[model samples]
Target: MVTANKKKIGLLMVLPAIILFIIMTIYPFAYMIYASFTDLDLSKANTGKIIGLRNYLDIFKDQLAISSIEFTALMVLIAVPVEMVLGLALSYLIRNLIGEKILRALFLIPMMVPAAVGGFGWKMLFNFIFGPVNYFLNLFGIQSIEWFGRPGSARIAVLIVEIWQWAPFVFLILYAALQALPRDILDAGKVDGAGGWKLFLHIELPLLRPIFYVTLLLRVIDVLRTFDIVYMTTYGGPGSATSTWSFYAYKVTVSYGWNIGYGSALCVILIIVSAILINTLTKVLNIGRELGLSKE
Candidate 1:
């Protein structure tokens, strides 16, 4: 009875946070779902009358919307894998090396800085004129390039910035997982004449699988909804070169006058995509448990 009373008090203490989550997250999401089925454009003082599935249909038919989705998908495909691979390599190197405390801190500096500052810093690095990158290129007799003025270059620039900012997170997580690995197993492998590459491939890599997937899923969701870095550097410019769904939505709602209904529809679609990805990941992890590969 005493334990039960303590549990009740603990629940009461957390109730305020639960209530706020419902009010701030659940309520706004529900409201967006309702708003998505309306015709709430600017220049009209209406709360938007219901327009059924027209907004969704139009979204599918809109070339710009299709293009933005494709661009975002492509970015996730490229940036996430590269970041993961680089981060894993860094983690492994640090794990096996001496005097790593400073190196680890240096790696994490990128993640610690503000996103806007990092984005602008990268932008300056790739600037066509008076930038260190161009100056280095000129040393090899290579022509100066317009990094953000072209579509291809703009995409490349944003991908670089994303990789730089988020790769540190992957490294940090993987390093923690490495520390938690069974020391006896690694020591036994070392004694059995296992080379570094072979040991990593046949042992360490398998053990790191769960962490890898978790990191991959997290980075995918983050990159999909990414806006600030791209917005600060390119503003989705050069003919919608680096335009992601989030940036496009912001443009339609805030910058280009209010199309609250359409913007809300975009938000709904993004929510649906995120939900689907989360559910799929959950199923994958459940399968891992059923196969005796991972803990719940």
Candidate 2:
């Protein structure tokens, strides 16, 4: 009776949170899905009529939207792998170094900064005339290049800012994972004439695989929804060259278009794409079972 009562009490305590989740997250998502198929223009008198898949079809027909989606994909492809590799390499190299804790705190500075602030700061550093990046290039007798002038250069500029800001985040997670690895297995490998690359590849890499699955998923999702840096630094300039999905959606909804219907549609597509990628990655990595995080 006591156990049953305690269970009931626990359920009662969690009821409010479950209700709030439905209200805040579930309902909104359901509504957004519905809105995506409607002509939900706030500016229009006749709106919210179900149109069914026209919005989805229009996404492909729109060049700017397609370009933005492509740019976002490119960013994810380039940034996630680079961050993963760079982070893992740095963590492995310095896991046993002197003042490791201090180095960790220092490394986390970029990730800790507010995204908007960091973006604006980077904008100044990349300024063509007197920015420190160009100033240093001038010192080396190289001409200062406009970071955001051309399509290709603008994309690279956004990428550099993204990689710089988020690489440390990957490093932080992997570095901790490295520190927590079982010393017994490592010692056994060393005793068995396994040293350096052999020991890491066979033993350490396997142990780190579970954590990598989590980190890569998170990093990819974050990149997919990228907005702050592009908004602050480039403003989707040089003829919308560096625009992202999130940025484009905002532009449609509020910036100039005021087409909430199309914006919602854009969001729905993004949500669908995100879901597909996440599901594929989870299955491919088998993260749940590998991490002992799933019940069945």
Kindly report the root-mean-square deviation of model 1 from the true structure over all alpha carbons: 2.6
What candidate 2 gets wrong by more than 4 Å, as runs, is 2-13, 292-296
Summed over model 1, clashes come to: 0
TM-score of each: 0.91, 0.92
List candidate 1 stretches off by more than 4 Å.
2-15, 281-296
Query: What TM-score does prediction 2 earn?
Result: 0.92
Q: What is the number of residue pairs that collide in model 2?
A: 0
Candidate 2 lDDT over residue span 100-208, tens digit each: 8888888889999998999999999989887999999999999988998989988999999999899999999999898899999899999999998898889999999
**Which ten-residue region of model 2 has the weakest summed lDDT?**
88-97
Model 1: per-residue Cα lDDT over 1-296, one tens digit each: 57988999999999999999999999988888888899888767865899999988999997778878988988888999999999999998986467799899999999999988898898899999988988999999999989999999888888988999999999999988888989899899999988689998988888888778878888888988999987889989788878899988898788876888888898889878978976797687664664466677
